[model samples]
Target chain A: MKFGIMVNEGPYTHQASDSAYNFVAAALEKGHEIYRIFFYHDGVNNGTRLTTPPQDDRNIVNRWSALAEKHEIDLVICVAAAQRRGIADADESKRNGKDADNIAPGFRISGLGQLLEASIQADRMVVFGD
Target chain B: MEEAGETKKIMYVNRKAPYGTIYALEALEVVLIGAAFEQDVYMMFLDDGVFQLKKEQDTKALGVKNFSPTYRALEMYDVEKIYVEKESMEVRGLTADDLIIPVEVKSNEEVTKMMTEMDVLLNF
Candidate 1:
């Protein structure tokens, strides 16, 4: 089955992000396809290429990026949420005449329309928040 | 071309006052994931959530880089149905022009219309 998952908590703030990642990873191991994964609010920090977690800990960003890359999944970052938190893609940075780009690989900076479209296309949309 | 058919719709209400919290981000994730599944998704900002739409959020000065910036990028995802309550904005001393992003600002009546139209409602 295909699934759409949203992770709103940052890895450092709560275990929700990690749990969502593990859930999706386990589902994939069981032969599930992730239709799309959305990072919002502080979760938007999940797409920052600038994150530097301790080496002893799991590199949540790397884990997420690798998972999406391995499965060729659609990793989406809410542009509004990300930008508010200082995560901007090259296109956005350039368009706004900003000096820096903060988008992480395997993730596309987008708007809520992508979320709307995902709901229409996927069978289930699960939200992991708080 | 209209659907002329019934489809499930979900509206996620984000009413938290940002800073010292993370609910706005969490609520937004639900909005996006739901949309990813191709479900009809809608979002509303009320109460302290009015701050979520405020512009000039440079949190870097406060050791953070203003989380409000991301809302501007929502258009590409097709999550265009963003809302803000007039009363909320007034209470916060905000005007549509003060927000960093362009959204369909409306009054309480308009907000209720959207809410009553939703098939499912989730608030955070």
Candidate 2:
């Protein structure tokens, strides 16, 4: 079945993000197709390339990046939320004249419309936040 | 008529003590994702949810800063229209004056009317 996952919680605090990650992995391992992952609000923090967990802690950002690289999943962040929080892609950073882009690869900036569209198209929209 | 394009309206209700548990924060997480999908998103807090509306929550002893500060920022994301049940406030020993932020306070009938209006209800 096709799945659309949504992550709303920030990585540093709650287990929502972690649960979402594990659920995505489990779906892929079960031979399911992950349509896309829509990050909004604080969930945008998970897509930040600048996120560096402590040496002893799990690096969630890098883990997401590697997962995307391996599975070719579409990881999208809400641009409105991202920019407000100072997380931008290369083009956004260049367009805004920021020092650097903190958005990770395989993840693009998207709007709520995309998430709406995915929810409409996918077989089941399985949300992972809260 | 409910059109095929019309998504289900799900309210991510938050009614819990903010510090002792992760329910309130978790509720916001759900709302964010629901908003990302542009679904008919709405959040309501009744009963203990009023505790979450309190502005200053110093959780330093637990090695955590006040995460309640983020609630104020939620409005900027177009997440306005948070509702509070007035009866829950009174029953829980809270008044409108005790709450930190401004919320749309409603009676039990009003809250029931709004909640029943939803097609899919998810509680956390």
Candidate 3:
């Protein structure tokens, strides 16, 4: 079965992104296809390349990038939400006249239409948030 | 991308107030975009979410954008299946007349039934 996922909270501050990653990894292990993982609200924070945690702690952003790279998952951050939270890609940064882009690899910024389309195309849509 | 003539019953469940957190406003953004897909979309307001539709909202004092006007424009976007929980309003001491738009005031049980009837359920 194909699964659509939405993560609605940022890392560290909430367990939502962590839980979503675990769920996606488990689903992949079970041989289920992940259609897309959409980042909305503070969840867009998970797609930034600027996060640097302690040496002992797990790197949440890099973990997602690796997972998406290995499985070729479509990691989408809602453009509106990302803009509001300052998570910008190269194109977004250029368009908005920002100094630099911060979007992590294996993730792309897009519109809410992507989320709606994922819900329609995927077998099930799962949301992880507060 | 969606196939031609393919549609899903998408429901946006709003259970938070408009301000304080960004869920309600962001949830509204999703609903507005979902309208373009030509799907069977429904917006259900319960708990403090029902407060999102109260009349005469003034966010000028709060220094935030007043988005209450968008609720009235929902019908223009062809999203008219609006519902408010009966118990949520009764306990909050609000009536249908107090809301800015017309909605189907359904009981909790009926709301649950309607939710089960949907193909996709999104909560905020």
Worst 10 residues of 1 chain B by lDDT: B1-10
Quote model 3's TM-score: 0.97
Identify the runs in model 3 with alpha carbons over 4 angstroms from their true place.
B1-5
Q: Write the per-residue lDDT of candidate 3 for residues A1-130, one digit (tens) a residue.
A: 9999999999999999999999999999999999999999999999988999998999999999999999999999999999999999999999999999999999999999899989999889999998
DockQ of each: 0.15, 0.11, 0.73
Model 2, global lDDT: 0.76
Docking class of 2: incorrect
RMSD for all candidates, in order, please: 8.3, 7.2, 1.1
**Clash pairs (backbone) in predicted model 2:** none
Given candidate 3, what's the lDDT at residue B57? 92
Descending-DockQ candidate ranking: 3, 1, 2
What iRMS does model 2 reach? 6.2
lDDT tens digits by residue: candidate 1, B1-124 = 2232446777778888766676766565555455545446677888998888877776765675466767876777777777788888988898989887776778999999998887555566
lDDT tens digits, residue span B1-124, model 3: 3553688899999999999999999999998888888899999999999999999999988899889889999999999999999999999999999999999999999999999999899989
Off by over 4 Å in 1: B1-6, B13-123
lDDT-best of 1 and 3:
3
Reference-based lDDT, each prediction: 0.77, 0.76, 0.94
Score residue B80 of candidate 2 by CA lDDT: 77
Off by over 4 Å in 2: B1-7, B12-44, B47-87, B90-124
Residue B28 error, candidate 3, Å: 1.0
Identify the candidate with maximal TM-score: 3
Span of ten consecutive residues with least summed lDDT in model 2 chain B:
B1-10
